[model samples]
Target: MAHAPAPKAATAAPVISRMLVHASEFRLNPSRRVVPAGVLIIQVKNIGQDDHDLAVRAANGHILKVTPTLHSGDLGTLRLKLKPGRYWLVCTIPGHEGHGMVRSFTVKKPVKKPARRR
Candidate 1:
């Protein structure tokens, strides 16, 4: 009998940006930081042996949440847009927040366009 050809695997969308958050005693890697006001790509890698969540609260009281059940050597990514302001990012897992998995970051406004010359 003749054999059939193997199926090709689907390619994933390329990540424009990435942020690595390591799980530890109540804190994210690089606890405090700043990002530009635009599409922000965040990748959370759970270096610990437990599942973790990535959450963000905007200055306008909006919330974004992502939970990745990270087994050892696992990772997840979240793509989001942020405005200029101060925001809070945290992992709300039980006992995780208190342990220091919370962090604060600022988003700056995009530069304005230059005026046209006559």
Candidate 2:
């Protein structure tokens, strides 16, 4: 008797990428200003002496993701899948953004690798 051909292994998607952001008195700083479109894990660290929270807003003024309020020395995380476009990181706390706690970033389409020659 002839046996059936073995099944080929399946390919899995890439692992989630990570980004770090620092929240201080009146500023929000990210480790990078540009990233590829995919699953993104944002980690926000409160390095100031007050309460702070982070919000991911789209260019159209819609809020996408947000992290819980973090106290001094506290850490919070926000996980999201972003499309290729412009986004802004801001502190939603009243008066915080007016103090300059906002920054812009860009997400680009991921690069595709050509298939290997058989």
What tens-digit string does per-residue lDDT give for candidate 2 at 34-73?
8889898999999999999999999999999999899999
Q: Tens-digit lDDT track for model 1 on 65-117?
A: 56565565577777887767897777777787788887888877765669899
Local distance difference test, candidate 1? 0.70
Cα lDDT, all candidates: 0.70, 0.94
- Maximum-TM-score candidate: 2
Error of 1 at 4 (Å): 46
TM-score of 2: 0.87
RMSD to native, candidate 1: 9.9
Instruction: List the candidates' TM-scores in order.
Output: 0.70, 0.87
